[model samples]
Target: MAIFTMMNSLAALLLFLISSSSLIAASDSPFILAHKKATLNRLKSGAEKLSVSIDIYNQGSATAYDVSLNDDGWSSDIFSIISGNTSTSWERLDAGALLSHSFELESNVKTVFYSSPAVITFRVPTKAALQEAYSTPLLPLEILSDKPRESTLDLAKRALAKYGSLISVISIVVLFVYLVATPSKSGAAKGSKKKR
Candidate 1:
């Protein structure tokens, strides 16, 4: 009789744990957000750099979900992870040592955008995962701004314009340093004469 009672107690505990886990997953499944998009057409010279600006608040709600970019014929010229204002509050992913980086989400009334950023292929642990985790549908995300407009020339021009001054300054400084550090022919000859 004691053995049977023990078995019954164990089964009840297991059922309770499963039910609670499912309830939690359900709550977080359906999360969503709204984001805005703009394009600077002149800078995308054979490169894809997309900037995302979340201008509005509570535009979309979803449980924790993932993002994915269309990956057909795709390559990342420069893959980067950047932070906006909510760096201290968001949970980060563990990609491994040497590859570990933060993937924090933007918060209310804050904006985060990537500069000459590579297009993302996707974000993992999808909506289904959220459902499984919390037994709720993934949160819904509403894109607030117009969808990203495609203009290769505009992207290239924009990129050049934004980074142009920095590039020119670096070039000038490098040239000046080279001229100062390299000995001219006359200087070398004068040094030999002085030695004699």
Candidate 2:
């Protein structure tokens, strides 16, 4: 009978420990979600300016502490942070909370495509762990020129400049046709004199 009692107590302790560990694991994990949007403006001098906005969200049940952002692979020469910071700190972010930041960058227009790396760091007290999360692959920015196209009149002027002799000959032929089609006073006077 004592042996049976001891076995039951041991089983109960094991079950309690398992349940507590599971609860701690569930409450200690933090999930971070991030997204980015970018716009590119191409300049006439073959340079481009990019504007980017990043949004971060805490989706886990625990609060995140000492939250900060970092750039992973972006180069300083190729990108300049004109408007906002590449790294920022937040005291704490509760679950379901959101943070947003914007950055403006300039680079040569020759770079057709680009992706900037973003990393987020936070601390979870329940697990006593410092964790890092990366943003999903940023959508690439494509530079496009909005230069005005040449008009039909402009094209004709250019063609005339290149083929001046041919156009002049055509103009003379058209003038001769006009004169031959219209009866002139001199021709009529000569014809009357001949008839007289």
Candidate 3:
């Protein structure tokens, strides 16, 4: 009975350690997804300034330190940071950092603009890294709009069309009232004779 009890206790402890380790791994892992936009809405074929924002969340017990993003021309020269508890402005931040960057683009900027993959590398301490992997996969950026054309008349027409039904009903009511209130020829002549 004593031997069996010892064996059972050891098995339980092993199970507990494995479950805790997997939980920690999940918490430390990074997940990233691309934001897509239409092709027409892409910037003009020239030097343009662009700002890119990325959100990073730390769900693990240990913090991620020395977070760095590697990309071609896609990275912003200046970075602006925001998170649930704080806000910061920096080109780079250490572990547990969420940052957004803004930068000027060169004329030949091709790879980062399209559906190209962007690599972002970050590190956690050996303790944390072992518990949960510090690296995340490439996240692609998509253009937000398909086309960039604009027209004043189109905007006005769209506005009118959106409220078109209401306008039509009001217009019909006004026309009916006008018809009812208008004096007939016979009534006008009678009023003239009465005045004389």
lDDT of each: 0.38, 0.78, 0.47
Highest lDDT model number: 2
lDDT by residue (1-196, candidate 2, tens digit) is 9999999999999999899757755875667888877778776667788877778888777788998887545567677666777778788888879988777887764544667668999988875668888876766555554548999999999998999989899999999999999999999999999998
Q: Write the per-residue lDDT of candidate 3 for residues 85-140, one digit (tens) a residue.
A: 12122333333434543222222243334323334444544544422122233344
Model 2 segments beyond 4 Å from truth?
1-28, 44-46, 144-196
Stretches of model 1 off by over 4 angstroms after superposition = 1-152, 193-196
Q: List the pairs of residues colliding in candidate 2.
A: none
* lDDT (Cα, tens digit) per residue for candidate 1, span 1-196: 9999999999999999899757744553332222333332222233223333322111112322233221111112322323332112123222211111123232221123232222222123543332211111222232122357869999989999999999999999999999999989998999999999
User: What are the per-model C-alpha RMSD values against the true structure?
Assistant: 22.5, 26.0, 18.2
- Between 2 and 3, whose lDDT is larger? 2
TM-score of 2: 0.55
Q: Which 10-residue span in candidate 3 carries the lowest summed lDDT?
A: 79-88
Please tell me which model should have the higher TM-score, number 1 or number 2. 2
How many pairs of residues in model 3 come into backbone collision?
8
